[model samples]
Target: MDFKDYYVGLGVSPDADEKTIKKAYQKLAKKYHPDVNPGDKVAEEKFKEATEAYQAISDPEKRRKYDELRQDYQHWQKRGGRGDYNWDRWQTNPGRGGSGSQGHTMSPEDFAEMFGGAGRTGGFGGFGGEGYSDFFSTLFGGGGGQGRGFSGGSTVGRGRAGQDTEVDVQVSLEETFNGTTRLIRTGEKQIEAKIPKGVRTGSKVRLTGQGGPGIAGGPGGNLYLNITVSPHVHFVREGDDLRAKQPLDFYQAIFGGEVSVRTFDGEVLLKIPPRSQSGKKFRLKGKGMPNIERPDQRGDLFIELSIILPDDLSEQELSTLQELANKRG
Candidate 1:
């Protein structure tokens, strides 16, 4: 296997501090997490690869040792070293008699005992089909180890929290106005999550201990429900505010009359001024969507008037309208 550069993969310097390494890993993990990009095989692989790099680089001892190995490998290449690499030297607990790249037979029971049957044969936990590279697994406590594997089929020590996961959920405009609940499925369990009122696109609802399984009896991770408000036929959301077109008869607009407009808070009356034109805008305070953060607050609603002409006009009425139009011109 080609030598994997943990620093290059994570876009960090070889001498990067622990906090910097962790921050970089978290950024990548959030972007390509399996729960966030479900069914995306490429993202899944990237997540795994990043996790492997973090495992190797996050620990000070591991990073120091890995740095030495990297320097040695670079020097060896400068000395005309071929593709052959000594992986056993970097193997975790080399004195434990692990055959690095030499191939060792592991019965199904033995594999299960070592990795808790997290991944398929020749793989790690949770992920299937050759998860971690043999190189990483050998150097780290990943595959083919007497260790406990976490999600993504990576083996780590006990007491590690499960991975937090996120799933996208689109709610109707009405649902955003009024608080709503949805039954979300994560793995084999179904959970009903309540989305608070006034939630818009990019809103997030969190459920603790609902994510990936923890490692070796560790606590489970949290689950995040990301909100996306669906489009409505008549309403467009801007923050907590709403914009909509309200229809009014031409006569009411021209003659000045009160018109009832539909709003999330039900029908609201608006008096039209004489000679009102189409696209006349009006604001109705406290008639828009509720604020998710502050339940007592609501946004204003803006209504743009859309004039409707009579389709069934008598001949005399048509002639009168034509005369009015000519006079205006």
Candidate 2:
């Protein structure tokens, strides 16, 4: 039956404004909300505590009155009068109507009826004012005549939205190029998720109403899938562009010809210019990864030429190469 400090409960200073009090209440409410911590009695208690604190400090008049009470209680304690103050009013009297008994035994229904029309639906964000504590009831004249409504149970409904869920989805680079559908397992069901073309690593997709189930008829939440793209065997991604090395024979580098180039889509014929040296680069437009948002648009693919010599040379080939070198000298 100690004095409840609304400011300390709400994690705000004595001079905190209404907005600051409201912010603190909202943060604590969300953390300890029954829906987020299902079947957890500790969280439920914390939620109620936060709700009560918010109710007392959110209103200017109530805050002023509570501050006055707090100051008086503190002054009494400083003067060593804490033992003399009547703490019996804070406790509930079990008897129906004792002659000199203090405090009243209040039921949940009676408690609800007392503050039924007091506009207990606003101020704090959607946490509701249904399960207020007896301490709160006593301060606002809803203390059930004499004894405060000290019932152990609350009268609030458990109507709260479900929590949002996040899951990681791994996709290959090829799958990103050609958008594919994947069967993702969530909870007790498997959902077919469509991976859009051009989805890169760290991309996120949201599915509506696919998160944890709500409580007491509240709306369900959303599910977010974080994309993790695997590395390609022969290609590397740079932003929206793709890079790869294409090997060409020494003859092709000396005497131009059509060489086959491998791309995500398929193989394409690339024309090699005459006298093309080793390490030459070529840009193939519109052949890279697609834009995530703009699937129709694609980036360019860069190809670096790697010239390779014949592993073994015949006697006639060596004689011809020597004659060519002599002519050049």
lDDT (Cα, tens digit) per residue for candidate 1, span 22-43: 7897688667766667889899
What TM-score does model 2 achieve against the real structure? 0.52
Best by lDDT: 1
- Estimate every model's Cα lDDT from 0 to 1: 0.73, 0.69
Looking at model 2, report the run of 10 residues with the lowest lDDT sum: 93-102
For model 2, how does the per-residue alpha-carbon lDDT over 1-329 read when each residue is reduced to its tens digit? Answer: 34688888889999998778867976886677666677887887787677667767777776777787788678667645624554222222211122221222224354235334322332223333233444555454333223323222222333344677889989999999999988877789788888889988888776766777765554556678899999888999998899999899989889999999999889999999998988799999999999886789899999999999998989999999999999999
Clashing pairs in 1: 118-125, 118-126, 119-125, 125-153
Q: What's the CA error at residue 83 for candidate 1, in Å?
A: 57
Sliding window of 10 residues with minimal summed lDDT for model 1: 96-105
TM-score computed on alpha carbons, candidate 1: 0.52
Q: Which regions of candidate 1 are displaced past 4 Å?
A: 1-158, 325-329
